[model samples]
Target: MKRILFVLFCFAVTSSYSQNKISKNKKAIIASVEKHKQSLIKISDDIWALAETAFEEHQSSKILADYAESQGMTVERGVAGMPTAFVATYGSGKPVISVLGEFDALPGLSQKATPDKNPLKKGAPGHGCGHNMFGAASLGAAIAIKEQIEAGKIKGTVKFFGTPSEEKFFGKIWMVRAGLWDDVDVNISWHPSASIEADVQSSLALIDFKVEFFGQAAHASGDPWNGRSASDALELYTAGVNYYREHVKPTVRMHYHIQDGGQVVNVVPDYSRLWMRVRDTKRSGMLPVYERVMAMAEGAAILANVDYKVSLISGIYEVLPNREGGKIMQSNLELLGPIEYTDEEIAFGKGIQKATGKPEVGMDSKIKPLEPTREHPGGGSTDVGDVSWNVANINLGVTTAPKDTPWHSWAVVSCGGMSIGHKGMIYASKAMSMTMLDLFESPDLVDKVKKEYKERKGDEVYEAMIPDGPPPIDEVGN
Candidate 1:
């Protein structure tokens, strides 16, 4: 009876603390984001114009870091050997809360900000994944936390991790390797998506590697018999992968891009190169599949009388969703209310839906209920998975594009460049900042979040699936 009474007392205190803490500063937190509305949109547009990719996002990275510094946050540039990666910090002491921001464009997706399909630069890079909005929203959240901390209302640390190369090389792996996130108590992250939701889902664990085959070149008509065809090996290896696909599980995905398949068909080609990506719902599920794929490459090389080299480029783990954090974010989402879209916005959404062959249900403004707990990841993979292993993290997706508009496409790029994207960006900023206030006010909540993280993660150690050298800067950038 005494223990039960004490439990009730603790719950009461925690409840009061949570309510009083976030409720008091909620207006100011929102106001901070509202104040930076136009500037944030300009920042997003500048990054979209640059359209840089992966480890080569020098201009975009500098723009984000410069803005963070302008807000009076201490900044560190060129972290983890990637010039575009950085960590901006404010406040001091324990219970370090961090926000993640990514700013990388996809290659070959350039599009003008129009309802119609018009390429801005005809095959140039573009913000197909809406990363332009992702970065600005996170920066807005961190700056709001800085406002509270500076005013002496919050006594914890606020950090913003400027992660680059998310679309290709998985830059956060190096940042995680550098122990940048080791001391963080909790991390907040969000993505621009088709709907607003507290993401309680895991992403796929993936690995990317490149294979190069070498052979002796010879004249096709004269000495063809004396020459080995590297293209033959490449074709054979890909055929084997396709044949083996029938035996693998449905959740596994294997894709490849043939960067080189010989210049001319007249002469026997000497060299060929290709990149491969392997993914699974869980990390363990990927090991055997990768082993079989590699073995097939060896067999192909042997049969084609050529030598092959395999280089592991980059790999990232599936996101481990934190329900505790997800619930907190959901509650905050409810507190903020649904997104209000104007008639013009709805028409704009329909335009994108028409262009993409999707049903014109317009934008998804309603906040979805929290997803049920699951062991396996969803479909896509992200570098934030690595950071989740190191710290307690929650990833939310805000409705930045039209409903049913597929991500990583020109359709998303077009919507993300305009007002629709700005509204979602501001919404995410408020949600993240308000959620951070909950953690700042109540240490009990932080402990609960950590305890849940430890329990879900178990005793498994983290190991990055990359080679023992620097990130593939030149390979990915060039």
Candidate 2:
């Protein structure tokens, strides 16, 4: 009995020591983020003001890459065939940890840092998705981890990925194909959301493509019979898609934008273009719908006597949820407690909620409990989903705007440029940094996270849904 009691006592003492070490390291990491808080906010604000679009974020990317380099990390810019994409690395050895940062803004959402809807520049781009915060906070976390490794408090490597064009082209697809994540043991990622959660939910899988129709132009009234209208084909294709929607599963979502239709009312258009996207809960589920939709374009062309071409833009996989990683992230969130808001911030949040036609409940200050992984999660798509498939990715969502503020809108842009978004960005940096410290300290934790990732991945092989050539850097806008 005494021997057994002694063994248990030793185990307890070792566990206590481990917990103390983790706590101490997390405090240091949090302090590092605090120490560089102003610089981090400046990075976010700079990117926010630049409001550069996908693949065109040259200055935005430079700001982040320069900061990472100044922090003693080696940066390789213009990577994976993208001028805005880059990789920054620090330290050496096993358990390579990677974090993703995106700095692209949505087009035509240009708004100033005011609660009222005021455009900073009419018909310009804005940080509606809060990627300005996403990139900065992620880099801040990576820098914190880099500092720990520099101090000999942790072992292994830390990599920061500057993945651009996520708003349109799914930039990470090309990055993954270039084998950027091949050596990574794990990835830490987060998004600026309206609520805080250790995101265990999977995202929708999506496919983006453009359909162009060609025909012969003629005056509408002068030679009606001689003209075959490409605009007619465009209309029929959209009509066919609408009719097919009722037959699809509840998990399916389809959207299209008519980029070109007709030049004038007096002429039959010879050319028309449409940007189409198809999405489902899983890539496997999305494939058949994408195929059918592509086929519909051919049918439309035949009926309208026009020639149509379908060009692949890009596609992404659903996020592979890592329960092991999520559990660790949840602990860190709980440790940090809910984000407290000052009265001014709360009133600002309420004003946003009111303006956006939602209940004036203000921001969600509570940390949402980790949710069960849904088989058919309902939400938008992301390029991070592709990276998660390649590596064990722990995802997080921190509130950067008020509750129920319509995403990808001026409301989010308003808060993201001000203190509300700044607080959340800092909060995300601390939570992610603390979680990374746990991963760095516990190799067993990394093993468990990878084990879960492999089990979930099973026999399925990852195949990117892009064309044979490089990413469409020349593609116009979001």
Specify the poorest-scoring 10-residue window by lDDT in model 1.
14-23
For model 2, what is the error of residue 204's alpha carbon versus the real structure, in angstroms, after optimal superposition?
0.5
lDDT for each residue of candidate 1 in 54-129, tens digit (9 for 90 to 100): 8878888898899999999999999998888999999999879999999999999999988778999998999999
Q: In model 1, which regions exceed 4 Å deviation?
A: 1-22
Per-residue lDDT over 1-478 for candidate 2, one digit per residue giving the tens place of the 0 to 100 score: 9999999899677556645655778889989999989999999999999999989999999999999999999999998899999999999998899999999999999998887889999999999999999999999999999999999999999999999989999899999999999999999999999999999999999999999999989989999788999999999999999999999999999999999998899999999999999999999999999999999999999999999999988899999999899999998887777787999999999998888889999889688998888888898999999999899999999999999989999998999999999999999999998988888899999999999999999999999999998778767653
Off by over 4 Å in 2: 1-22
Candidate 2: minimum summed lDDT over ten consecutive residues — where? 14-23
Model 1 deviation from the true structure expressed as Cα RMSD, one decimal place: 7.0
